[model samples]
Target chain A: MSKRSIIPGFRLSIGISVFYLSILVLIPLSIIFIKSFELSLAQFWDTIINPRVLASYRISFVTAFCAAIINTVFGLIVAWVLVRYQFPGKKIIDALVDIPFALPTAVAGIALTALYAKNGWIGSLLEPLGIKVAYSPLGIIVALTFIGIPFVVRTVQPVIEDLEKEMEEAAVMLGAYRLRTFLRVVLPTLYPALLTGFTLAFARGIGEYGSVVFISGNMPLVTEISPLLIMTKLEQYDYAGATAIAAVMLIVSFLLLLLINLLQWSMNRRMTANS
Target chain B: MAGVVRYHATTKKQTREKHIDESLVVRWTLISIAVLFITIMIILPLTVVMTEALKKGASVYFAAIAHEDAMSALRLTLITAFIAVPLNTVFGVLVAWAISKFKFRRKQLLLTLIDLPFAVSPVIAGLVFVLMFGAQSYLGPWLSEHDIKIIFAVPGIIIATLFITVPFVAREIIPLMQQQGITEEEAAVSLGAKGFQVFWRVTLPNIKWGLLYGIILCNARAMGEFGAVSVVSGHIRGRTNTLPLHVEILYNEYQFSAAFAIASLLMVLAIITLIVKAIVEWREEVQNIHL
Candidate 1:
């Protein structure tokens, strides 16, 4: 009912949105979908199931998932520290978390490579210990984790800030130990935000290119990611194949996010009902 | 009698309970992991870039700037940001207007689509533009016939960035609009203000902070975009490559000092944006306190 009050009678704005989104998002996406149609079902399967492509998928998904999981755990901590603790330069550290959000992914990749490559400073230190980070799956995980952490931290930070400290105190008074209180009370409250962060970080990691490519060393089936493989396909002029594989990536990412959201929604509902 | 007993038991619970360990192990562990990640990934890399640039000395730093490609990269980055930022700001406002003001079929779908670039792989975003404009689609033939080249060109690079950055301005403003009730707009309309006037005079001022935040975000994203632009930008020195792409090129070609010099420049811009956002947010908080 209130929606009718806001429309100031302008078709111009609405029309422009339709046109812009059509040309920019829809047309390009349709072409990608249509290109996949040009390939036979068997060819689509073949393209997606190729050893190199399969390897890239494994590298991308498994690494992204792992990075996201790592981010979920650690990002929550960072968020908690920034929100609950007051310390010197805490605001600066809080802002620093968003550096990955602003820094160009490629630049990030280059920087990470410069620092983590065998001859680079950190890599040199780790090399003596037989821990190779750059040009390996470990590098991908690090980059993804770097970019992914901010999502979780930013997501969970506000929730943590707004958390009712009195409730925790009450739980303590009710004889719940600190660990039990966290596991039973705090974790349940933070679950939705955590899931939201996980999905965002996972989605971001899955498609990340610039940062990962530099340190990844990009060996086929080793450090190669799906995005890189898609780029390789485009360079090779295999449009249909690239689109097919990309579609698969897209579907997998969407399904994972949707499933996560469903679980989050159900949890949120249950929490509301219980509280 | 039982209810009274249970209430007394609840009240006495703390008396019998053991004092809990409050070492904050889980919280501290999470914090430690984040701190470690930052130290290894961002802080160390940033230090190396700083060290590399500083080792070159101030004279070398300026000389690196005086280098031809580096200069062009700076100029090209400025040109692209100038072109992309205002366009995105205007489009983003219109998008925010449409999404926030209007209700239609699949409204949430449109919002989701607007956010697609943020979710989708930037590489995929660039690849989609190629598929659309890469001499293969219906428009590809028409665009070529009309001498409109997009892929592997400057325009293609800008478009790829545009796609990746479409959400910032709109996203920043949407929540603000929801938070700020539409009473002012209604008041303006009752005074016989036209649609454009209402937007320009009344609506813009109310949401200006949000708009500024969005513009800053758009500038950062557009300026630093690499994953999306790398696909479409042919990386032609001074021609198609944006600054980030330029940094990547220089680094790949073993121009480490020059790369860090440029990296410092962009880092300066990012830091400037950070400062501006902090000031704006602080100002907004102060205003909220007063109101």
Candidate 2:
């Protein structure tokens, strides 16, 4: 009668799901395991931790984390604005939030590169100010931000809209100040959505190449991302190394996301219990 | 009664909504900031790409667009997307139907597997296909012997794009299906409709809007896919290059206007998709209200 009945029956659908999963998911993931199997344990460790590889990992994860954090804070503000108030260009801004989602990563990257490249108008201005953007780690952050903003903004928007305003008014009527009401009342409802958006944007930025590559200038340790490092490894026919790096990324990303998911799950469960 | 609960919600929220109008000015300023970000981040750069694209004049732009390698890349991208999109759509609908309209063991596992593509990099996605279809794997030799090259061929592109994009349609459709109860199907069955007809007439019509949303997302991903497609494409200019790769080639070679011209075309298509998506989403919202 609930989530159960709506889906036909357990056994038959599970059987169908298994067949789909085997073809679609398991075999593909296993092949990565198999490819990495070519290397011994020490070789696996050596392959994944190559200095260039480590550099890429640092740049990618650091910039992605930074970008995700930026998106989380700014995106929350943006979502709050869209939800709590109506203004000129509100619908347009709402529509614009999806640009990063729909835009091609390569295209977005190229666009960012053009905007911030040495001779580019924006880049030219920044260059005169002694602030290098394109062809640096900074450029990588800008590109990732360009592509990942939508994930945070869109994810947070619906939840912000879903929040009941009466609750806010009640707290205000009870003499809680605006910031306190937001911190004590509004923030709680929006936290999980913010976390979800942050996680998704962070995950997206970590592996992002097309957008970052054009802008990063793909320097070995300076601006290169993990995915680009995998590409470089594979291009040099270092199949073992590439798969090893991928496997590491897989394991680490899986663990991290699993943690975030658990966090989200617990939060949702708490909300359900409270309500 | 349930009526009272509904009445309370409508009345309370309505009164509260009017008070919120008097609530904040900073909100609008922040929204304008968001709008500014999108404009600077997205629309401005796009306008630049277009401006640079047109600098060489129309004849040259058309010539660049008509360039054989670019033509082949565009065709190949479409060919792969066309093959992959329908297959994925069918797969998405089946998976959604099974997950939504039926119960299953390890259901969460299945959903997780389906959603894995979103979290993983597409570049890695290409590697997974290569691992299976390249010269090293079990099937690679068989596929190569058949002269049916998949790892570095059209099939490879399709498989890679499909892998990277599988979640798009299914994710879009599931929420709608959840909102839509299966009563209509049950009623159709009661009226003697077979499974096929029940699905053909009853199910498909209801979810068409959601399906379109997924398809647009899938098609866009397929066409614009660079990192994964680039890996598998072998960068063969006339052979494996998709439009994105072509743009990369032209830009790298300093054919700036030509590259932007082609890139601008793709942007036009993207803009069209965005417009269509906007409409469909609006329709979906309207439909939601009625539902």
Candidate 3:
């Protein structure tokens, strides 16, 4: 008798998947590069390097970096607390960490605008200190940080939970103080996860548009982000300009995410080896 | 008796001196900081959505969502999600099966390509469609000649949504199925089960929860998608305006109450998505324990 294959329909399934992915993802993404190439080198350089575009790129990168840093610090704290402590409404707090993931970005934008507008709730409090959040670069950072929080918290939480408390106990038993034990024993273990979270947050922040637009005020050469600038170019029917900016974003973000994944893979290997 | 009393005293002293956990002050401080951050960043925004929606009273809020354009926007959002979610769901299952069950060359590259959409900016996702089908492209003239409009129309909205959410279901299911392995299916096949029968009887039961979770997330994203859909939607009121676009129009028109009211509806959907997600996670945990 002929031996039958264990998993049937491999050809059919692979065919459909390859065809669908090519049409929906591969082909469309390639069009961006091809369309951008339609411009000569000088045109591409001018489109991407004009003063306004440069300013927007700077603002996008700076704010995203700042937001990612802030998220790393607070996200670690949040993840640490959720994994180690028992508190009232713990489940709800855990659920709330994912609100940004599930919440519509547009809704987040409007709600944040309402809270931080000069006359809004939080805005009223900060205004006394001459701090403006809504319609400024600060507002853009706030929105990015809000959306990026879950990335850090979720990434680090499982690692924290899986950590063996025995190592910490042994350190304490060796006469290490609380702060010393955490710094030496715990921080090294968490460093890779923290870095991964930071990179992911930074990557997402770079491409974020919906939540940042209303809060950013879109002031050219000031608060304009690369994504918003791309939108403006599209609205004006500047397809080449739009695709050029988008291609730059795509390359930078793709490289950053690839680096992060590599870091994570290596970290996983080290962790399993140590255990 | 004297030795026993001395041992008790030493044990009490050790208990007092050997406390290794964080100080009460430090613990409370960290907890408070976490709570404060969450409140300011997450909780505040959620409450603000509801408060602002009702700031002008319930009647006005109700009227805002009941407006003709609002209803049409709601319908369009539902229609687009209904089409996009199922299409992606089927595609997700097929892709997950291929990658998890079969060996292939360039497997890692295929996986990364699948995730390309997530890394790409949503604006870019929308732009690619326009570049391919807008009035300026090669297909544009041909499609227009046939009276088929893909850009600035319902078809454009659906395509953009599809692109943005294409990876959600597959990403969720691939790892799950990989962990499950194929031994059960292999055994069932060797026992005389047909392809469809084996999948339905053996694989489907194991993956149904994960599939549902993925579908919920994909549907939420499809319904809430703004950036990509906004780029191609043309913002035609009562025509191509999805719910998010409608919120944008109302906000831009200086109708704050109406905008927040419409936003609150989406917020409710977000809440429901989170609840379902939590339940699915809990169910998965229970199943893992059983295993």
Candidate 4:
């Protein structure tokens, strides 16, 4: 048998996959756009640009952005410490990093709310300091940060491990100090991975509903997120409004994902060229 | 040459000592921050789930979990996973086989299309279904005349879960099958093995671990899916409610102990998922080292 034709069922396999995805993913997703088209151009414009809708878009984007930034900094630190340092319970900490990914977001939501509520453990501590966490924009960020914790760590970890130690040694031999070596050599190489992680986390955070809903207090124009707004509209039977807002969020998320894929492709190319 | 070598070694030793002294401080500081951050962010929530669940004592915790609605929610969650995971797995395997074994055009686009669910918001995922099949959609009236309901029903929940889990198994298997190549299958075919026989004997064994890894991940998300399931569930107690939704209802009703109790079950599931994941990765690594 020719190697190319050795495995049969190519036609059957591809046909089934495309048909399955079309039914489950593509066709349903297309409904968002089609349904939203029920609104006139001006009506669609008014629905999306409503102040409450605008506020939600702002809140969701801003909080997700802040959370991604937080994860990028702290996630990089966690990834670095896990890679470079040998601490007691290192394995345990490493395992725990994936908790956010594994845990149901609703569980995380209520658990985090319990921990950060006014009478809750950490919230009680922060209450005396006048720093409210739960039921505020800050709480939204916390939920998002928790949701996104693994993205940066998992994305940057293998890259950090695969990093050439010899490069750092060479820099040291050239009279660069420890700080300089990392800042000049290590940080530059990590930028693409960090950015990719940041984008993923940000994308996830923007659409996050389960975790953020509990902590965000659901206050309209203040704590209301875009996803929650969609939920609210659906609950009110405002299907047109719901699909309109959903369409906008969908477009932004798709753009962000496309960017990440492009970034990953380039990163892979760079690695191959270097090796 | 000997004198120069000696001088170089002395300078290197001196610089190393100084560097260690300074780097030690930086290292410990970073480690402390990382440890403290994780403890607060990850561990504290985990601890709270258990503590709050048991706050009213073990009896209350057990009572909460054994409640009629809670049990039904669990049943519903299992059913959703039971249906969704297998369908996705079959589709995943077929997609992986087609993409990996053949040199095809627009392969990248195919992969991207497969990953489309990962990018989509769960709320949007549910909304898409509602838009497509809900009572207000184009198909809704005709479906109602036929007495068939999709949205706000079990089918909707399953569809949303399937949408969210579409990429898992295929993603896991694709690269693995590609790396393993078609050599073994070709060898089996040359020896007069038939198509299904080649796949069953040669291809399945080589990619089993990755396939399992994918299934585990798909099942985890399938069981834990909240937002997508939530939208279509309609929150009808004991009927459409899944486990996560049950937690939300109990929590919202100020049944704190009950909510956490239900949540604790999911917490355990998540932890078990992590342990299994770690084991799989370790086995893969060990296999690689042996090879």
**Which candidate, 1 or 3, would have the higher lDDT against the true structure?**
3
Per-residue lDDT for A11-112 in model 2, tens only? 554566567667866789788988778789999988767898888789989999999998888788777777666567777777777777776777777777
For all candidates, what are the clash counts?
1, 7, 0, 0
Two-way DockQ contest, 1 vs 4, winner: 4
**Tens digit of per-residue lDDT, candidate 3, span A35-67:** 878999999999989999999899999999999
The candidate with the higher DockQ, 2 or 3, is 3
Could you give candidate 4's per-residue lDDT for residues B1-291 as a string of tens digits? 443444344345344543423377788999999999999999999999999999999999999999999999999999999999999999999999999888778888888899899888899899888888889888999999999888888888998999999998998899899988887887898899987787789999878878888998888899899999888889999999999999999999999999999999999988888888888778776666555
| Candidate models: Cα lDDT each | 0.80, 0.79, 0.90, 0.91
Residues A74-146 of candidate 1: C-alpha lDDT, one tens digit per residue: 7877787776544456677777887888777766777788888888888889999999999999999988988
Top candidate when judged by DockQ against the true structure:
4
lDDT tens digits, residue span B11-119, model 2 = 4545434333444565556777767777777778887888777888988898999999889988998898898888788778878887777644666666677878877
Badly placed stretches (over 4 Å) of model 2 are A1-17, A267-275, B1-25, B289-291
**Which residue pairs collide in model 3, if any?**
none
lDDT accuracy of residue B43 in candidate 1? 74
Q: Which is the winner by DockQ between candidate 1 and candidate 2?
A: 1
How do the residues B214-285 of candidate 1 rate in per-residue lDDT, one tens digit apiece?
Answer: 899899998888877888877788778778887888788888888888887777777777787887788786
The window of 10 residues in a row where model 4 chain B has the poorest summed lDDT is B13-22
Docking class of 1: medium
Per-candidate TM equals: 0.90, 0.92, 0.95, 0.95
